[model samples]
Target: MDGISHITFIVRDLDRMAEFLCKGLGAKEAYDSAGNNYSLSREKFFVLGGIWLAAMEGDPPAERSYQHVAFAVSQSDLPAYQANLQALGVEILAPRGRVQGEGESLYFHDFDNHLFELHAGTLEQRLGRYGMGR
Candidate 1:
């Protein structure tokens, strides 16, 4: 209870969303309820790097937004992830480039219109980039 255990996002199609997360982000399907809600996780254990991507049914249709979230990844993994995403027919931001300071990073958006960023740097290095460290 010290921190957020999981996050849930409402999506229009469970199957499609699941596929997107699995293939595009390397998330594994952990569970799915009969109600069409599913969860994806990086590993079986819940640790500092453990993350869960849950998709639930939504109404009023799904719309794209500028709002986005980011995830950390190895710099070496960025190109492959981008390639995988492109293979899945996902739209990526143009002029894709990397920012280096504490660590290198790449930014892109997902099918659900969520912006996600991948960073390749240590915690301290990343924190310093945003002046989080002094």
Candidate 2:
């Protein structure tokens, strides 16, 4: 495959997820099914950082886990994302320990039990830091 075409999330409330995407994560709504089932069920689409993200109506996972999708973010904007997610009442997960130069990360769970991470580092940086085995 070339790369990720899109990421689809199974959510319960489209409106709520929309708010979380648009307001919390700075995503732009590309489409909304509006109760029209063109595919498997009702769905909505959003463009987040030039990536197509789909939110489909369905039963979310029953348990919360460490499984998550991470997005690249600048260090300066990390605090703003944290504040916005907190203001929206989203559950913020404690960040894991990290060595210097690996960069910062913010972890949180959405209403549908989907965990997300906003990371401020690139793979090269992470590998470089890890190479020292500190």
Predicted model with the maximum lDDT: 2
Clashing residue pairs in candidate 2 are: none
Model-by-model lDDT, in order?
Answer: 0.65, 0.93
| TM-score against native, each model | 0.72, 0.95
Residue-wise lDDT of candidate 2 within 47-78, one digit each (tens)? 99989999999999988899999999999999
lDDT of 1 by residue, 1-134 (tens): 68766766666666777777887777877766754333332222111247766667564135656565567788898899889888989876764443568776666765556666666777788678778995
Error of 1 at 132 (Å): 5.9
Prediction 1 TM-score vs. true: 0.72
Superposition error at 35 for model 2 (Å): 2.9
